[model samples]
Target: MKAHNSKKVIQYSYLFHKIGILDDEQYKQIEEYHGLKEKKKY
Candidate 1:
């Protein structure tokens, strides 16, 4: 996946999680699938 797209997905997922729209498990799945969570400065 492109880094740009992955970054957006991560950002949006975090927003959803923060707003109570997504649970921890779902947020973890999205983060893992996106593979950008490993980058500390992404």
Candidate 2:
């Protein structure tokens, strides 16, 4: 269950990153804040 939620978060983050909504640093900060273990390789 937790893994599913994390995957959704990652998907949203990736979409935001691609759309220029969030910069690289901001994305990293969000991932860190969420304690995401698997970092997406832009």
Candidate 3:
């Protein structure tokens, strides 16, 4: 179960990064919907 969860996290993280959807504006929109800000690297 733990491994499965980790895999899912990694998969989604890769998908997000590949799509270039990690900018400040998109992050804010995601935060507004999900109720928390994501830690950004750039």
Candidate 4:
């Protein structure tokens, strides 16, 4: 539905803006940490 898709777009934009505040180094570190956690879980 159009409304459902619009809601998803808003959520994605919100997340993007939230992460946009972080510097690239911080983002990469967070990503790496999550990757390690995922590997451990598997």
Candidate 5:
């Protein structure tokens, strides 16, 4: 469930960024944070 939600979040974040809702920094922040968490778990 968590992993699924994380994927959705990343997808949405990218979509938002692509559509001009989120900037590069904001998108990268979210992506990096989740990437770190996933790394820590694995």
Candidate 6:
């Protein structure tokens, strides 16, 4: 269970970091364009 949770954390972190590659303004624009406040949770 511990290992599984750690893997999830790593996955989430990597995903967010990948998204972070976009410029902040672009990201914000995307969120607003999509009417989202944050990334959707699975």
Choose the strongest candidate by lDDT: 5
For TM-score, candidate 1 versus 3, the one ahead is 1
Q: What would the per-residue lDDT of candidate 6 be over residues 1-42, giving only the tens digit for each residue?
A: 544554565555556657776655655554454433223322
What TM-score, to 2 decimals, does candidate 3 have? Answer: 0.47
TM-score (C-alpha, index-matched) for candidate 5: 0.83
Error of 6 at 5 (Å): 0.2
Check candidate 4 and list the clashing pairs. Answer: none
The regions of model 6 sitting more than 4 angstroms off are 21-42
Better of 4 and 6 by TM-score: 4
Question: Model 3, 1-42: lDDT tens per residue?
Answer: 544554465556556756885765664454443332222211
Q: For residues 1-42, what per-residue lDDT tens digits would candidate 2 score against the true structure?
A: 665677678779979999999999988886785555544422
lDDT of 5 at 15: 99
Deviation in angstroms for 34 in model 3? Answer: 21
Candidate 3, residue 13: lDDT? 54
Candidate 3: misplaced stretches above 4 Å? 23-42
Off by over 4 Å in 2: 32-42
Write the residue-wise lDDT of candidate 5 on 10-41 in tens digits.
89999999999999999999998877766777
lDDT of 1 by residue, 1-42 (tens): 477788799899999999999999999999998874446435
**CA displacement after TM-score superposition, residue 28 of candidate 4 (Å):** 0.4
Q: How many residue pairs clash per model?
A: 0, 0, 0, 0, 0, 0
lDDT of candidates 1 onward, in order: 0.85, 0.74, 0.50, 0.57, 0.86, 0.51
9 Cα displacement, candidate 5 (Å) = 0.4
Instruction: Flag regions of model 5 displaced more than 4 Å.
Output: none
TM-score, per-candidate, Cα-based: 0.77, 0.63, 0.47, 0.51, 0.83, 0.47
> Which 10 residues in a row give candidate 5 its minimum summed lDDT?
33-42
* TM-score of structure candidate 6: 0.47
